[model samples]
Target: MTITARDIQLKQFKVKFRGFDVQEVDFFLDQLAEGFTNLEIDNRRMAESLKNAKIEIEELKAREEKLKRAYQELKKNLVSLKDEAQSPSNQNTSRMIITEAQRESERILAEARTRVERLNDDIQDLMKQKEMIDDHIRKAIELGKAILKNNDCPTNYSEDNDLKVKHLRQIP
Candidate 1:
């Protein structure tokens, strides 16, 4: 069982023959009680200190948790910021791509214009050839008519009248 200074101070012993000296034993007991009281005081002080230490540890742990949560939040924000930063570069890249496409479109349009010009030139050449062929056909018709007229094939035939001869013998 636990002993207290008060228990030690109030302790009694049955009187015995040839036992410890009464005054000396009493004085020793008194000194031992005083020592016990000092020890109890020290124990109480240590217990209080230990209780305070436990409270401080709990507070520190709570603060650490709060700081950890804050750190995690900051990390998440940093990641989000890092992701957000790429959009402008992507937009710039898209703009560059669009610009390139527009340039390519312009190049294609220029090529089409050149092709159209060449086709127009070819068409003009074809038109001239057609006119030349028509002139040749007309000249051949005129030559045939002149040969018939000069040979006295028909006396009624004239340039103003179309050839409506029904008989070849009508020509003299």
Candidate 2:
């Protein structure tokens, strides 16, 4: 069962003449519940942050794909323009048009290259962020395991959680 702070607070134990101190147990449970609640909040926040980062990455990838397609189209147009410029008819006009087109294509290509480089850098930064978050999560899990071990509780993590960690590590 997923125990909540309220459940911990409301938990009851049978008392005997020689039983452990009730107040001390209650105080410890309260502290544990508070810590658990904080951990839950942090986990939720991290998940949301991860989700946002994934969305941003997807959008950036889509933009990169569009830019690549545009670059290819520009290349094809440049080739066509060059072929037309080679013809004898309207040689002077063709030269001028070819020069203008070349300049424009070069400018566009340069801008596209710059944008792709920037996007690559952004992706690297995001990957670093993801690594840091993953590290934090691993640390949290280790801490939880330690806590459970100290309490003589089972520390075996769920297979689903392991699969998720593996999946995150697999992300490129």
The CA lDDT of each predicted structure is: 0.53, 0.60
Query: Candidate 1: lDDT of 101?
Result: 51
RMSD of each: 66.8, 10.8
Q: For residues 1-172, what per-residue lDDT tens digits would candidate 1 score against the true structure? A: 5566687677776656544346644665676667667656655564565555556556655655665565566556555555665687766655555566556555655655555455456545545654554454444334333433334434444321344243222322
Task: Highest TM-score: give the candidate number.
Answer: 2
lDDT of 2 by residue, 88-125 (tens): 88667767876776677667657766765675676567
TM-score of 1: 0.48
Residue pairs in candidate 1 whose N, alpha carbon or C atoms collide under 3 angstroms? none
Off by over 4 Å in 1: 86-172
Q: For model 2, which pairs clash? A: none
Question: Positional deviation of 31 in candidate 2, in angstroms?
Answer: 0.7
Question: How badly does each model clash, as a count of residue pairs?
Answer: 0, 0
Candidate 2 has a TM-score of 0.53
